[model samples]
Target: MTNLNASHASHRNFILTGIPGTPDKNPWLAFPLGFLYTLTLLGIGTILAVIKVEPSLHEPMYYFLSILALTDVSLSMSTLPSMLSIYWFNAPEIAFDACIMQMFFIHVFGIVESGVLVSMAFDRFVAIRNPLHYVSILNHDVIRKIGIAILTRAVCVVFPVPFLIKCLPFCHSNVLSHSYCLHQNMMRLACASTRVNSLYGLIVVIFTLGLDVLLTLLSYVLTLKTVLGIVSRGERLKTLSTCLSHMSAVLLFYVPFMGASMIHRFWEHLSPVVNMVMADIYLLLLPVLNSIVYSVKTKQI
Candidate 1:
């Protein structure tokens, strides 16, 4: 009876934590976080506007960049509210349904961003491997279709997650590890059997983000092979230069992401603060860094 009552209360209500060990530091932390988030929006917005206005920037590469920018904004926005509420106002209470929706958006936008990076890799590959046929191959229609396919795949894969989470009875403590809800965090609190949720979550990450990483690596390998065949040292160097920004963006995203994931799975002994910091870096800092690298490095941008 006690367990059932705890489950009932926890299922309907939850409290978000801001850096498990430092409540006093949350307000101070909010400043840097808020500043970086604002810069992410401003920088990405400028990039999107520039791409839209410039007729010369309407190619496949720029289009993929635009999609990525939008996804980054969305990905950041999903956590902005809960994070700010916890840091500035000390308001950590989030309803169950709202939490689930937030998690869904975060995963969707994140997966979409991964897909966009893969697309960008392919764009670079095609541009370098067959410069002449690039325009014809990645035409307007093709770009549109790629965007649709990416979104559809994300939506389809994540659609069942909410249902899976909803069925679980959260009988454990309602205090979350981070200021925002995460699928993994939520699943861990469930008192009932979570085999299905765990299995499905693993499957989703493996097939979506994992597959994206593999595809991006393959695209780069093929691109490198093609670049090596180039006889002119100057031409090869110039071609590789075009890929520098994209490579930086990928590292900015995947490094922190992989770090956070590893900490969650293998290093549970580590401080909760490590996971919180890493999550912020992955979700918040990555977009700001990506905007800076692309804007400063890409001459056309």
Candidate 2:
């Protein structure tokens, strides 16, 4: 009876304590992930190459577009390599420090991207509403200042997230459920109370992601109002078309993001695989689609 009780206790412990296994052991999962990563890299690379070769594309919009492409490439590079290795090479282990670093840069590029998108929307608004002042308002000096401000803002905002994570006392459970070390998953492993960490995460989300979306929406609203006041129906339609493309990209990115957040926070029964895939759609797929929409619709590429 004593031996049987001990065995039961061991099995219960195994069941209660989540342990990560080889993610790539499932071939069905590996192939789709591999293909998506390849597509993301290739799409961003081609955009950057075209921007470099076309001298006419050196204006503020394409300049920012080039920066956007580079950010997407960097963002994918940060997460995809490790994800691919885990799924294809059967490597499931990541050191705790490396995990923190990954989470840091992931948010870093994410914040920068958000800031860049807001800047892009503002650029479009000015171009459409005040074409005469467009060149003067968004001159080379102003673009340089905007770039500097974006980098500074991103650094200031995201610097504390990784530091906060690093200070937390992680217990023995180093295995993250998702493909990467998401902030919430890392916090869950902490033996210490994580109220502060959770609050900080929420703050970052509200200020960076929430604020960016709000500002972008506001810019489009004002742009649309101004465009409607124009006398020419054809001109108004053209402006609406451009704004619609941007709005479509924004909705594609944000809807999935909010959905994933809700599922991860409220719905525990949903599979971690589904959550990670949704995150991939929000982070990687949206940016790739943004490049495509802007390129084809605006005829800038």
Candidate 3:
């Protein structure tokens, strides 16, 4: 009887508070949030459309750029509806299944975006290293294959997350801290033993995001080495300049990523109010900043 009742409560609805902390008095903040959503959509959507029709922009770099834009859109869109529901309409109640589904999409696409960025770094390395054969090496077929591989990898890696979440009995407070479902935040809400959840979560981050970041850095290092060997200073400058936008994108994404990780680990030490504020910025700031960065830095955009 006790176990059955526990299992029933585990499946009960979960509440989503705006950002994971106490409510803010400034309802006016929604105006800027709405602007961010619009700007990100317009900027990235324009780039995606332009890349589709322009043959000159159909090469690997822009192909990767399109993927990056698409990934950004996916990341933003995953949490967008729920966020708008909470902020614009003042709705907060989220069913357990809905929360899990949302969590799956967010982490899966988040991993895909990281993978895409790493692939973009490799694209840069190839263009810089073998300018003559860049097209031959990374043709349309190859880029398509790379995109498929990224999606496949993300799906397989994140496939176990929801199952892992389901295996645990969430008998405690069902209220989540953020407007959207996050794997780590949900894990904390599980009343059962979370050793599996915590350990697997750590493993996924280290193997997926950590490995992707390391390889991306390595690609840049090799590209830098190749560029430095060029005798002409202008040539070196031009070659390195191609990477400026990508570097900006990486920083914008990674800083918030690392901040969220640090906050997750040291959360007890910090003030409760700051957690919600930081989570709000971490989730929403990247796409807007990325759109602006690419538009200003990339000539074609």
Candidate 4:
């Protein structure tokens, strides 16, 4: 039985390789990506440091913002090293286990980001919609519970992705079209039937990303309505201003992601380079932009 399992796993191995002779393609692209990666780290690090050092920011909102920054940093780290290595040393071949590890963390941080955003929305809702109850509702214990809830949701939603990938038979093509082992791209290399993998992927999309977006929108909708109800213009503006950072960050992250996913899924004939560029935009650029959007707009961050 053990030999049988090893055979099955061997058949499932995907042979990844770097781009031929010219291992490194565009050296120029690396400069910008490297800069952006630095900026992302710096921005997120600043936010986290501030949240930790400043006692004034011990509230639920700042806590969630710190988590958001941390998640962005983690997400960027998961892919940037491989991307940079490809650009610098031309080491494009990732081992099967390493590839799977990258995919796992990518999904993990992606889901965690979604959860953080949702929790931020909820925090804003309580602060704006129920100010009087905010203290009672989001105290220290409550914040801990919320943190656990977010982590739990992220873990539960993304757990199946790596497991499903492990179970799939990949006896066919080994080369992944993209730089990373994206779920869909990996599925395409499967020798066995991919129907199960595809269906599970769809379920993850619907529950993890889809539900998070829906909840975020619902929270903002209610928040907007509450803001409008305020009679004092000064108070209303202040409330909306507080939410601007998070709202902008959400748009920056989700819009391009949805667009890229739609293009990849429906418009299969799109250029592979185009898809790679889009992935970079969604994964790296978006996180860097989120830091800027939050810090510049919400100076408190």
lDDT of each: 0.91, 0.73, 0.85, 0.79
Q: After superposition, how far is residue 218 of candidate 2 from its true place, in Å?
A: 1.3
Residue 166 displacement in candidate 4 (angstroms): 2.3
Where does candidate 3 stray beyond 4 Å?
1-8, 19-27
Best-fitting candidate, scored by TM-score? 1
Residue lDDT tens for model 2, 1-301: 9875543331101001111343234545678777777777777788888888988877777777777777777777778755765666657567666777888877788778778888888988998988889878888899889888887888888788787877776544555666676778777777678898888888888988899999998998898889989999998887777666566666776788788878777885877667766777776677668767766776766
Query: Regarding TM-score, does 1 or 3 come out ahead?
Result: 1
TM-scores for every candidate against the unseen true structure: 0.96, 0.86, 0.94, 0.89
Clashing pairs in 3: 20-177
lDDT of 4 by residue, 72-109 (tens): 89899998767766666566677777778788888788
Worst 10 residues of 3 by lDDT: 19-28
Best by lDDT: 1
Global Cα RMSD, each model: 1.5, 5.3, 2.1, 3.5
Better of 1 and 2 by TM-score: 1
TM-score of 4: 0.89
- For residues 1-301, could you state the per-residue lDDT of candidate 3 as single tens digits? 9887866577567888764333673355568778888888999998888888887887999989888888888888888877877777777788878888999999888889899999999999999999999999999899999999999999999999999998888777888877889999899998788899889888999999999999999999999999999999999999999999999888887877888788888765776556766666666777778878888899976
User: Candidate 1, 48: how far from true, in Å?
Assistant: 1.0
Candidate 4 achieves a global lDDT of 0.79
